[model samples]
Target: MSGTSEGPTPATDLSRPSVTQSDTTMCPSTEPAATAVARQAVAAAPPAPPRSGPGGPLPAAALTPMAQSAPTPVGFTGLAQRPPAAVPEPPLPEPPFRSAFSAAPLAMAVVDRDGLVVSANDTFGTLFGGGPEEFAGQPAADLVDLTSDARTRHAYHEVLRGGRARLRCARRLKHPDGHGLWVQITVAPLAPESPDVLLSVADISARRELQSRLRHLRNHDPVTRLPNRTLFFERLSAALEAESYERGGSGRIGLCYLDLDGFKAVNDTLGHRTGDRLLAAVAERLTRCADEAGHGRTSAPLVARLGGDEFALLVEDSTGTEQLAELAESVLTALQAPFEISGRRLSVSASIGVVERHAAGTSATALMQAADTTLYWAKADGKARWTLFDPERNARRMTRQALVSSLRAAVERGEFALEYQPLVGMDDGRLRGVEALVRWRHPQFGTLTPNRFIALAEEDGSIVPLGRWILATACRQARRWQLDHPDEPPIFVSVNVAVRQVWDSDLVADVAEVLAETGLAPHLLQLELTESAVMGSAGRPLQALRALSDMGVHIAIDDFGTGYSNLAYLSRLPVSALKLDGSFVRGFQHEERGGTAGRPSPADEVIVEAMVQLAHRLGLTVTAECVETCDQASRLRRIGCDTGQGWLYSRPVSPDRISELLGDRC
Candidate 1:
C-alpha cells in the first residue's frame, strides 16, 4: 500500500472528462474482469437515461447535448438498456477486389435489379467512353448492346433469374467515337442472394474480320473474284439435297457447262495476262446473265469458274427443258459481242451443254458428268452452240462403249459369224458370187448387225483387228466352196472395208496374208469400199488401195454416185467395179398396182444408164445392188448392168445354205 497523500482533490472539471474505477460497470458480464477493469472509461455519472423518440435507438456516446434537441425514438435503448454491441462495421472492404475490378482489361459493370447501372469500373469507362459519374443513374439497357431488343433482354433475364449461370454472345455496341464496336459479351449474376449482375465485354472486331476474310478466300476465285469450283460444287450439292426433300413441286435442276472456244489460241497469241483479263471479263458477263435470269426469284443462280476457260452455272428449281434452252440461248447471245481488252477487240464463243433433270433421282457428280458429255456433243455438232442432254442418245453412246469394250474379246471369243448374200448373173439368173456380211452374236442384244457396231469399232481403232478377222474368215469360206465344187464356175466373195481399216491397218498386207493362208485366188476375193471412202483416198490411203489392186485383189466401189465423185482423178487409181447404190434400185419399183407396180423411175433409169456408160468407158464392171423385183432386174439388165445382188436372189444365208443352193443349182 502506498502512503495516501490526502491532498484536497482539484475541483472536478465538469467541462472535462474524468476517469474512475467505476468505469468497469459499463463492461458486459461476458467480458473478463481484467478486460472490464483495464478499459479506460469516460466519467459516467449514471448511465444516460433512456430517451423517448420515434427513431429506434442511440448509443450512450451518441446522446450528446446537441443530439438531445432532435426527435428521439420512442423505444430508444440507452446505456442502461445495454444497446446491442456495435456490428464491428464489417471490416473495411479489401482493397484488392476494388483494385482488380478497377484495373480489369475487359469492360465490366454492375447493374442493379431495377436495370440501372449501380457502378462501372475504369475499364468500362475507358471502353464505353463514359465515366462512373456519367453512367450512374443511367438505365443499364442504354449502356450494353443487350436489353436494346426483346431477344437480348430475355437472355439477360434468364441469367438474372437463375435460369442460367452465365450468358455469352456477340454484340454490336455504339462507340463514343461514332463507330460501332463489335464485342463478345458475357454476363452473370453477382451472387445468388443479390439482384446485381456482372457484365463483361471483350472486343472481337478483329476476329470477325479475320473470319470474313477466310470465308471469302475459301469461296471466291482470286483472279476473277467469282465463286470457285469448290463453292459451285457445294451449292450444287446443297441444291440437290434440298430438291430431294421438297414436296409436290418440280425439283428439276439445270446446269450449263461452258468452255470458251479458241481460248487457248488467244492465250498463245496475247500473253497470259491478257488471257486472265479476258477470263475476268467473261466471268463478269456470265455473272450478269445469271443475275438477269434469276431476277425476281428468291435465290439467284450460281455462276463459277472451274479453271482456265471453263465455267459453270447452277440453276436451282429449273422450269424444264424449254426454260433451260432459253437460258442457254440467252447466254450464247450475251457472248456474241466482242470484248475490247488492251486496245484490241477479241472475239470468243462458248459451247454449252444444258442438263435438266428431277433433283430427287440424281446426284451432283452424275449431273456434272452428264453436262460434260453434252458439252462435248455441242462441240461435236459444231461449236458456238448449246446441246441438251438426250438420254436415248446417251444410252446409245454407252451401248457403243460397251460394244467397243467387248469387241476386242469378241474375236478371241469367236462371237462373230458370216452370212453370204448371193450375186446372180443378170442375163443367166445364176449365182455368180456372194457378198460376205459380218454379224455379231452378242450375249445380251442377240445378233447385232454391222451397222450397230461398225462405227464403234472404227472409233475405238478396233476396226483394224476386226477387219482382219473378216477378211481371213471370208477367204477361208470362199476357198472351201471353190474346192467343194471344182466343176462349177468359180464364184467370188466380196468383203466391205472401212476407211479406218484402210488407213489404220496394213490392208494390202492383211489381204495378202489372208489369201495365202486360205489359198484363195485374188480374183476370187473382191474387196469393196464406199464411194466416199475411195473418192477421198489419197496419200497413204490411195497407195494402200493401189497396192491391194496390184496384188490382184479385185476392188469395187459400193454406193456409187452418192459421194462427190472425181472421175478425172478416178482414172489414175485401180478401181475394178462400180456397184450402183441400193437407193437407186429401190427407186425402180414404186407402189403402184398389184404386180410389179410402177414403171422403173425415169430419173433412176437415166442415172443407171449414165453410170453404166461411164463405167464401161473406164473399163470398170457395173453391178446393180438391191435387185428386189423383176422390174429392177430387167431395168438393170436393159441398162447393161453385168450382175445383180439382192433379197430377190437370197437373204444372206449361211455357208451351208449357200452350198445347198449351189448343189441344187438355184
Candidate 2:
C-alpha cells in the first residue's frame, strides 16, 4: 500500500527530533519531503526580538520576515516590494561605451530617447551654469532657448531624426547673465542607437568679427578706404540688372570713368604716401560731387576707386543726356578746386568719359570700354574736360590706335624716310641749306607728311629715337652731298629737334656724335627749336644748348613770332637765326598790296621792311618760311631776309630727287 498510494506522511514522522548543532535531522513526509523539512526548520528556529537601541541591527524576523514567512519565489512581486538601501551606489561603474557627445572639445550634451538631457559633460554644465545632476532630467531643448530660424530648426530636426550625420546652426543662446551669446551649434546622431543625439556648441563672436573684417578688406580699397573695383563691379552689375528689368521704361544708367591728368607727375615728384593722400582726397571730392549730382535723382551715383589715379561713378535713373553731362561737368568743376594734402595745396584736373544708356543689351564691358575710349578723347582734346561717346568717333579712335601700334615698327622696316626742302638764299637765288622733313610710307595709306606723325611720335615719346635717327640720316646725306659736289658752296642741314628729345636725353652729346660720325662740320649742322620749347627750357635744356653753341653748332628758332615772343630773352639766348613764321611771311603779300593799292594800311611793306631792318640791326638773321609764291620770295629778299623756304622752290623730296636737284643746280 505504501508503494502504490500517494498520500501525506504522519505528523509524528514529520515532527522529527532535534539534533545536535553538528548533526542534521530530516523529516519524512508524503506532502513532498522538502516542504515538510522547510516547515520544521522554521518552527525550530527562534525569532529574534525587536531591538530597542537606536544603533542596533534589526531583528532577523523583522528584517527578512517576507523571506521567512512564506518563502516567496525569487524574481516576483514579493521580492520587488522590498525597498533598496539608501547607501550611495558606486557611480554605476562608468559605462563601457564612450558617448560621441562627451568626446567633443566644446560644450556638449546628450539627449536620450525621451528628449531629456541624459548626460552632460563638465563643459556643458559650466556652459549652462549648472551641474550634470541639475541638467540630467531637464528637457534638452528647454536648457537652450533655441528660438532659431526655421531652416536652422529643420537642420537640427534632421540631425535628431538621423537623416543627416551632423547639423550646424548659428543660434542665439539666452545666457544666465541677462545677455544672449551667439553660438554655433552642431548636432549629430549616435550610431546604432537612433534615439540619442550629440550637440556641440561654440562661441562665434570673435570669428564673426574676423569675417566682417575680411569682408571689409575685400570690398574696400586698402589705400583710399573707398570701394574698390570688386565692389564697383558688383554695384554696376546690380544696377544693370535692375535697369534691364525696368526695360527702359523710365530709368537710365550713366557711367563716368575719370582719370586724373598730371597725377603721374605728382606721384613721381611727391612721395608715394603723398600720392596716396592725394588719391584719398580725390576720392572724397568725387564722393561729394556724386552726392550733389544725385540730390533729386532716384539714386545717387556710386563712386569707387578703380585703380591708380582713376575713379568711377555709376549714375542711376538719370533723366537724360543733359543730366549726365551736367553731372560730369560738376565733377570737373569740383576737382578744379585745389586739394590740400600733407600741408601742400596741389591742384588737379580730371578727364571724364560719360556714357548714358537705357536698359538695353549694352553690357558692362562694352560700356566701360566706350567710356575709357571717350575718356582718352577727352584727354586728347586737351584734358580737364568731358566727352560723350559717339560711334563714329570711337571707330576713328580704334583706327588711330591701330595706327599707333603699327608705327612702332615703321622706322625699322624702312617705312619711314626723310625729304628735304631747299632753303634759298634771299640775297642770291642760290640754295643755302635744306630743312630735313620726315615722311611715312605706309603700305596701305599713301605717303604721309611730317605733320601727320610728328605729334604722334612726340606723344608716344618715340620722337627720342625717331629724332636721333633723323639727325644721323640727314647728316650722312649732307656729308654725301658735299663729297659728291665739292665745288658747291657748303650747305647746312637743319634738323628739327623735339622738346622731349632735348629734355629726356643728352641732346648735345647726340648732336656731337652724329656730326663726328658723319664728318660734317659743326657749323654745317643747324638745330631748329620751337620758340615755346626754348622758352620752357629748364636748367638741363639751357646747359644743353650752351654746350652745343660752344661747340660751334648753330641753333635756329623755328616758327618765331608765333609763340610767346620775348625779344629780350631771345637776345640773351645763344641762338644764331630766327625762322619767321609762315603767318608773317604770308602777311607780306597783304603788306605789298596795302602799300601799292591803299594809303598804306598798318600791315604795310614799309612796316615789314622796318621790322626786318631792326632784326638785322640786332645781329639776327631772318629766314622767311612758307613763301609759296615767287612774289612773296622777292618781297622777302628785298626786305633783307637771309633765306626763304617754300613750295615755290620745291616740296620736300626724297634723297634721290635732292641729288638730282643738286646736279641740275651745280
Candidate 3:
C-alpha cells in the first residue's frame, strides 16, 4: 500500500478523538509531515510481532508460526522505517437493513402478512416485557388485543397488504404480565416491494388520563358529581334542536325547572357544610328520578344542578305535556321523602315548572325563562306542587312587565293624563264631585285605563312614584278648574289610592305636598282607598290615614262591602264616605222583556237601604257606584245615598270635557 493510502488518517484514525483531547492515550493528536511520512510507511508494511525489546521487530523466536492478519500501532517504537508501499482498496459490503430498526427509541417491529412478528427491536421487547427472540413467530395481534377491536384488525391487514402507506390508532393493549396499557400504534408497509409490515407504538396512557380528568371536571359539579349548568344548558340546547318521531314530526322538547322550597332557611340555620351534604343528597335523588323517567328511551333525560338549590332536567324527546307533568309530579313525590343528612332527617319539598312544546322556534333562553316564571306560579299557588306553563297567563305577565318598564319612564316623561267622572248628588241632581281617573297615553297602546296597569304598578312597587305623580297632577288640575270656573261650586277631585301605596309610600306627606303646591283645599282633594286596604291598615298605614284625615283631607272607603267588612273598624277609621262596590249597585235593575223600565230588585233595594242607613248612622256619606239608567238613579236616590257616580252622569271624560259638563251643571 502507498504511504498516503495506508496512512493513519484511515488505519489509525486517532486524530479526532471520541473523548476530550486531554485523554490522548486512547487517541493521539495530529503529527508533523516528517512523522506522518514515517508513520504512514510503517503502517503500509505487513504486521510485525509484538515487540519484546525497544523499537525493533520482535525476536525471531517470539514471531514463531503466528502471522498477523492486520497491522497494529506502536507508540515511539524508534525503529528505522521501510520505504512506502502501494495499497489496494478493499471491496465495500452491502448496508445492513436491521441497523436502524434495532437502534430506534420507540417500540418497533417487522411483521409478516399474517401479523406474525419476524423481528423486533430491544425497545419493543422491553416495552412489552419480552425479548426479540421470544416475540419472533408470535402473532402481533395477541400482544395488542386485536380481538377487542375490529378497526385495528382491518388497519393491520391493510398495511401488511401494501394497500395503505401508513396507519395509526390509539388503543389499550394487553401486556404479558396481565395489565392493560394505553398506546398509540402505527402500521406501515416495511418497503415498497417488501411483504412485511412495520409497526410502531408510543405510550400515551398519561396523556389520555389527563384529558379524561379535564373533561370530567369540566362537565361535572365538584360537590355533587352531577352535570353542571354549562353541560345542562348544552344538553338542553341540543335537545331543543333535536328531532322527534312522535306525531310524525320534528322539534319537541320538555324541561322541568326545580327549586327547593325554603332552601335558604336551611342554609341559614345549618352551616354551609351541612348544606353541601344536603345538596349532594338531593342531586342523587333527582338523578334517580331522571333515569327512571327515561328508562327504555333512546334519548334519556339529563338532570343537572343549575347552581344553588335549583336543578333542571331536559327531556330530549318528550311525548306531550302530560308526560312532562308526570315527570314533574314524580320529582315532587321523590322529594316528599325526608333526606337523612348529617344524622338529621330533614323534610323538604320542591316546586317544579314544566314546559313542553315544539322546539322549532323556541330558544334555550326563552324556554328557561318560561320555566322560571311558571315555577314562581307553582310557588305562589302554594308550594309542594308543579305548574304547567300557560301561554295566556305568561303573555299577561309579560305584558304587565312591559307596562311596568314603561310606567317607570312614563312618570319621568309625564305621559299620564287624568280624566274625570262626575259624582252626581242623588237628591239635588247636581254635579257634586268627580273621581280623578288616571290614564296612560301610551306611545304604543294609546290610552290605557287604570285597570290595565294599576295592579301591575302596585305589585312592582312602582306605585309609590306613580301614585305621587297622580296626586300632584290631580290636585293641580282641580285647582285649575276651580280657578277657571269661579261661578261654579268648588268640586272635589277624588283620587284612588292602592293598598301598596298606603304601606309603601308616605301618603300623608305626598297628599300634603300636593295640596300645598296646588293651593287646593285638602277637603276638596278626596283620597279613596279600597275597603280592603283601609280595613287591613294598621301601624304606619293606619297612622298615615289618620294623619291625612286630621288635615281635613276627605278619606273615602271605595269598593265597600266587597272586602272583609269589619263593622267595628268602620266606626274607628277616619272615613268620610262609603262607595258601594259596583257589584252591589248592578243588582238594582232586572231588565224586563219589554223595553219599559222595571222596578229595582227587592233584595238589592234592601241591601242598599241597609248600607246607606248604616253609613248615615256612622255620620258618613254613601255614594252608589254604577248607576247606568234613570231607574237605577231613582232607586239610589230613594235609598238615601248621598251621591251616585256612574255612566249615568258620564263615562270618564277628559278634563276639557268635564269643564263642559261643569258649565252646564254648576
Global lDDT of each candidate = 0.74, 0.71, 0.75
Q: Which runs of model 3 end up more than 4 angstroms from their true locations? A: 1-121, 125-181, 184-201, 222-224, 242-250, 262-288, 337-346, 459-461, 499-513, 516-519, 536-551, 567-573, 589-604, 663-666
Mind giving the per-residue lDDT tens digits that candidate 3 earns over 1-666? Answer: 112321221111112211111111111122223322232222323433333322333332121111223333323433222333355233222122234445556677767788877556678898889775567767887776554456656656766676755555556666678876677665655434446666667776676677667867998898889999999888777666535333454457899999999888888998888889989999888888888988887656788988999999888767899889888888888898998888989888999999998887889999999999999999999989999999999998987778988878888898988888999898888888999888899998788998999988888888899889888988999999999999999999999988788787778888888899899998898989988888878898889888988999999999999898888998889999999999878876764345457654567778889989999999999998998888788878887999998888899988888788884642
lDDT of 1 by residue, 421-487 (tens): 9888888877889999999999988999899998888888878888899899999999999999888
Top TM-score model:
1
TM-scores, all candidates, are 0.70, 0.56, 0.69
lDDT of 2: 0.71
The TM-score of predicted model 2 comes to 0.56
Choose 1 or 3, whichever is better by TM-score: 1
- Against the hidden true structure, what lDDT does model 1 obtain? 0.74
